[model samples]
Target: MEFGAVSDEMEVKAPAAEAWKVYSTLQLAKLVVEMRPDLVEKFEVVEGDGGVGTILKLSFPASTPVFTYSKEKFTVVDEEKRVKEAEVIEGGYLNLGFTLFRVRFEIIEKDEITCITKTTIEYEVKEESAANASFVSTQTFVEIMNAVATYLTTKQL
Candidate 1:
């Protein structure tokens, strides 16, 4: 099995604390759904207390270019560091040939009113599924960050 990882970083216009609140809670999904329902048809907490063990079931609309749905569980949450990690334990990624798919979101505090969002994706794709894995785009994180930043900036007004 071959392992590969991709990382994307975005400078947010809001404070680290504000960005942390958005990234560390379920609010992030809500923002995504509100801002881009076409990309996410549904977002629900299937289990857990919205913590490290929390399970989220995400459904994608038929117009979505990627997976139709995914079941992910929070594997790590470090509030002090403003970091959260989730693993796609079931759903489309697995069906598309990925043996493992995990995403890590880190909000770095640069100052009182600025921060950077670092998104990392680690995956292991089976040899037979390698051809299908090329469609995975890291730019999705950038788009999400832009949307969240816009939301936070407007909320502060």
Candidate 2:
């Protein structure tokens, strides 16, 4: 098994406030569930202002059952910077690893009716539990980001 991380970036046609509504809100988890109901079985916000220090209980469904990493503890949120951070993820059945994930959304207002949003994801993988687990996580990371972008973009209009 080898430790690895996945990062992805995307652009959205929405203003920063619009983007923040999706990225900064805990409700955005619902968008993830809506996009991939098969992967996101259950998600519950545990704490915080729903902005920072929020823990999400993430499980799975068929075709994308998440057997590892049961929960994520989000610790940072800077609306001014459009950034949020989470850590101490349980890489269940994998490395029992501790991981951190950060998402930043920058809104570029192009016009009154349109805004361009750029999103970035950075991850830190602490250990490798299994080769299969590593593969699954990396793939899921990309899928999750893409799903978020898709979810937000579809609502832009």
Candidate 3:
């Protein structure tokens, strides 16, 4: 059995190239943490390049605590479309309640200096972990996108 999906979109003030540079690289979690360590305690790349098959381990701050540690692997990377998809292979959300968790990020060019960032989260819950479903929030991705947008815009100037 599977739950529904959630999707969010935000327009960034930076160009598609800049957004792609950040998202298409394995440095995504690192870059975001560097800009906002308050939100993330640490981000480590366990394996692979920014491309498909990359694995990233992430730790969150106690303040916004969820899963202290999470391991994710990139399942898809389409640079030409500026889209990347990752799945939770281990840790964090899975340990909490989710049976399956995956996210897809798409950066679409709106103009020479602007782009739209879209994130879609698809998940399924374990029967025993239904109560823990509340811990999963799509807003987290929106906040991350906002943070990344701010960082990229600042670096562009």
Ranking by TM-score: 1, 3, 2
As for model 2, its CA RMSD to the true structure in angstroms is 4.0
Q: For model 1, how does the per-residue alpha-carbon lDDT over 1-157 read when each residue is reduced to its tens digit?
A: 6678888998887899999899898998999999978767789999987689999999999987667999999999999989999999999688888998898999998888899999998999999888866766678777888889999999999
Per-residue lDDT over 29-128 for candidate 2, one digit per residue giving the tens place of the 0 to 100 score: 7877778776676687666557666778777775544353366666677777666665545543324332444444454556654555554545544445
**Where in model 3 is the C-alpha error above 4 Å?**
none
- Rank list by lDDT: 1, 3, 2
TM-score, each model? 0.95, 0.67, 0.91
Q: How accurate is candidate 2 locally (lDDT)?
A: 0.58
All models: lDDT?
A: 0.88, 0.58, 0.85
lDDT of 3 at 62: 84
Model 2, stretches more than 4 Å misplaced?
A: 1-5, 65-69, 91-142
Could you say which candidate leads in TM-score? 1
Cα displacement (Å) at residue 18, model 1: 0.8
